[model samples]
Target: MVQPANKRLVTEAAIETRLTTERLVTEAAIETRLTTDAASRWGAAWASGSTSRLREFFAANTGPRVAITGAPIVGTVTVASQADASALVGKEVQGGVYINTPDLELRDFRIKGDGRYALIDFGPFASRTYIHHIEFDGQQSKDTNAGLGVSSGTGPSDLRVEWNNFHDLNDAAHTRPGSSYKYNFVHDPLVWNTAAWGAYNPAIHPHTDGFQWLRGSGEVVSRNFIEVPYKSVSATPNTNSCLIIKTDVAAIDNVTITENYLNGGTRTVMVNDGGFGLPTNISFDKNRFGPDFNDGIWQYSNASSMVFGSNTWAQTKQVVPTTNGSLGYRSAQPALDPDPLGFGCVMTNLGYGAAATWGAANDARYVRALSGGLINGIEFHVTVSSGNVSVGVYRGRGRGLTHMPYDLVATSGTVACPAAGAARIAIPETWVEPGDYLAMSCDNVTMQLLLFSGTAAPLFRPLGAATAASHPLPASAPSPASPGFRMPILVGTFV
Candidate 1:
């Protein structure tokens, strides 16, 4: 049994050492800077074969505490680092607000495919591991491929994926748990039903993502952006929500989801249950969720609330179907019955301020004429789905208002009613704007929410000679009493 290829190299070359940035330029500074511009590129590098000299150079000069490198990688070229990582991620093209296409491949390391997904070594030249700022593309597929994978073997620790973007790859959205995936872009990397995340993994397992069975925690997936395109008539529109922490009987705690944006995903946020029960102290706050291809915030499709909310959903907007010019429809003839009668849209132009009673499928839209006073309250009514259902109101400049609101009307519901089985509720329209609002569905059943304002300040009072009809005063008519004053409260109250 001669020494294995990976083992023999580590001991003889003293590849387990450490190094620093400035040292690479020194005669005895420790690291051997190769094609890498930054000496730290090979700081703790290691690899498997003769091409692995890049890894050996970094490992032989370890001890630079600022950072540590993983096994040196080479695919199209032997370890393309420095400005190479940027190109692989498909950035610097047309990403506004700093969005990018994640297109990458890690072709050096290997994973045993025993179905258990066994771990392979990062070689010996690198004793420690660190995932640098890079991008990975999943080919818009929903498989178990990973940017960085973790198998059953290996007692590794302290890993960090920071300041990087993982988007536009349709692989599973799950990553190694217990690893800190923060301040990095984890967008649209893809989702292939990958199971469970070691979200608390600092390196291999950091012990803070609510998975406690491993007695590990403290890794987080936070403060980045996520986006998925609706498969606009293609085949499969690339999309999936944030992260998944399957119920692996692992106790996960102190998981934090904050200050990020998730746009156009038809799935749930952070999943807290997997039959193994939700990890404790799990929270989601200050995150922006917008118009998904489907629902906004989906906690569970087969279960109930698994995670609590102290979550902050601010200024984020979603476009929805409202009584606005584009979505509204006016009734050409009010002679037709618009109750719970039709199945599809029959009437049109049911614009704002119109009564909230129409058949099940009446096309109606309404608008409000305000005089700059608080909107007071709203009274809404509607029927429910005969099957399980959920309903809520949406108001926004560009988002689903129900994504975050002052009050949550109802959660789980069944049957077909809006007040009993139905919900007749009062929503505070305390402050109204030149904005728009609409009613939408939360469940996949017959959905409806009819609404009207509680009481609004009058725009102008009638002169007794006019009502909504009668001897209605003309707009340019002279007053019966004062000079220069034609519109006066002849009968209605001012306050």
Candidate 2:
């Protein structure tokens, strides 16, 4: 009795209902799978006690968040000497404090500072220092550099900073070696007023950061909430990063950053070697990144023994991809002050003199590989290019006396000299193990290559002398015990 159109409509409705049911079932399956995965991961983590404190410290609904009200001020106290700092056990006090002594404990304090730092410790070395349960409010002092600043004096300071609130400052903390920063909240950095500063010059205005590790080793940064909002009040870019691991002053090793809620900045985390050496054992694991950031999440350069795992987004819980970048002479050097030319030069064992004359016909420089990977090509800077050059890879001898190239492996055929600048010689993809040596040879002495001097030079001895042709390097290159004055900027690009 129904028309054909009515029957078609009913059939379509039934199909649509069935499709909706299937979609719901699929979604439910996905939800169950995700829940199971999360439970398994969390259960293992909890059982081991590795992530139990991290879960309880930064959980939005259950964690005890840091706030200014938590530090109830008892009275105002000025800590200038070791005696004064040692006396601040459980008192909730105010004002800037200087800490240069060992075995001191500071807790439950509210520091409102207008100076450069709330707690400053420029130590020869301060061991067993604990700072916790404090609030550093820089709202009253808008021009503060950091809430806490600890410099690596002669060695590790061995300071532990935890459970603190830091806000309204340029940077929350600037730490060095032998430090552990955990369970702290650092957010809402001071918005730069461009009108007052005329322009946003980084030298004068200073790009803000949450934590800046200038240099050193054996440091752990975990379970913290660090955020520097993008365009919070102003339009200009004033913040640098939430965390910056830099080796400008010295080499860094054994630094672990894990299980933190990090957000904002130009880049949220930046690890730079500064052409000093490859920072080793640098790990970034199980951290969560927030949505608000001007640039990407993270970047690194010249870092060896690096581990990046289980980093996820806070909103979606999806894994974040690796964003790797390099700086210094390892790639192309930026046009900053104290350029590569200003670093001066050193004579290579290949018979190049201090004046850059090719004294020896066949001279070579060897650099140890900090990581194991397939090298695609060799990048080097030619200060005075006249003749062709060749690159070679060789097996290292043993661990201790492996300064020079031991056994021949692979070599890039002689390539014509390029003009004075950065040049790349593409070689066959060669597999290099960690601690292997990369060697370079020049045909003529006039072919001057750039070298690094001062603190930026490599710590290991890398120069070797050999009398051999450009195509096939010598079987063995003998190196001296002393590191000498210069390090050749011969970098191997990896696949």
Candidate 3:
């Protein structure tokens, strides 16, 4: 934590007398009230205010452009020079705000700067950064996903984009950053990339994706409300998806997705060309998806390492079987971040997973069930060699070694998606005991789990299986180990 100190900057006049320029530091801006988006620095919410005098507000601004620095730049914020977005290679940017400035005093509106947007080529972005509560209503997607993007000049690392909303993107060439969390609502969902035709207007432009991350993108998505975009008269630019994450193991890894609601589209969620498959080390948890869609959290390619967690669904195509709790994506989450736990296995309940690929003898042998409930969708992470891996479930009464139940839950074998074929495995339902642990890891990397207690219905446990050769479990929420995610399966739903 960056603590505020007694030592302070002695006014700009005092500093100007000594230094050449007031290169406002990321830390100092918060103390001096000069930087409006300072809250973002400390993992806090970014802020911006509105004003009545829209022009005056935008005219009297500094940095990047005239109307977007210091405080929340409303009215009209843009770049002083219309150059390529890549030009912002090394320029450091503070947080973005969604409020009115002293001048603009505008209400409930955030406008993007004109011309090409900038990219904070924060090399590899070792540090965690965020863009929240702001709106890029008038911006044009210069890259894959939206107006502003973070692409390093050389190294490619991980970055976080959250809580922000984008709508009415002007242009939609393939240039947009295809890999991002499009949980935000795009009022004018699609404005196709027909820029080549030279006959484009917002009114006639077809609607498309809300938030989509194509190949070469790896980031977590949660707490977003996504809707399907409108169809264009001449073209169908957008499909319905809160997220369109192209699956390519080489491009993305360790992406955590949770707590989002997507609905109303030709395809409600997970629209993939199967260029590769889902990125590796990705987890989907606690999201609510509704009707008017074809598939529920699906991918075709053999991208490895993906987990789907507790999510709710109201589908029109297949009614997502009750047993899908452990099969398809979602079907739900910890509301608050559980306080840290010590280092040990805090096994309380047990969730049932199945592997039919092991052959029909074991395929239809076990039941697809969770002893706890749906909300108790437990998670356990382990490392497995790129082959058929079986997870040994060792449940115990508390943490005592002797108390470890002898095979309380059936051992689960992953349907390991090899280059040739993939397999299906039932997700564990009730395996955790709902308590914090010191630390948990299966193979080597730290793993998390959620064995929820079904809230809406009885612990929806399905007991059927086929060759676990190509099908994998649904989107498991992130932090499989954290507390607060409880399905609280009601006994009444059983009848």
lDDT of all predictions: 0.30, 0.59, 0.32
Off by over 4 Å in 1: 1-128, 141-155, 188-216, 229-238, 300-495
Sorted by lDDT, highest first, which candidate order results? 2, 3, 1
- Pairs clashing in candidate 2? 350-363, 358-445
| Tens-place lDDT digits, model 3, residues 1-495 | 433442344455477865643453633464346334422331221111111111112222211222232444333233222132223222323332221111111112234533333222233222333323344443444233334322222333333343344454432111112234432433334344565436555454433545544445446565445544222122343444445555433355556666555553444444344555455655677655543232343432343444666655422112222222123222222211111242122223344422112221111111122222222222333222233333322222212221112112222344442232222233333222222111111221112122233222233222211122211211111211112211211110100
Which predicted model would earn the best lDDT?
2
Better of 1 and 3 by lDDT: 3
Q: Which 10-residue window in model 3 sums to the lowest lDDT? A: 486-495
Q: Is candidate 1 or candidate 2 better by lDDT?
A: 2
lDDT of 2: 0.59
**How well does candidate 2 match the true structure, expressed as C-alpha RMSD?**
23.8
Each candidate structure's TM-score, on Cα atoms with residue i matched to residue i, is 0.36, 0.48, 0.36
Query: Would you give me the overall lDDT of model 1?
Result: 0.30
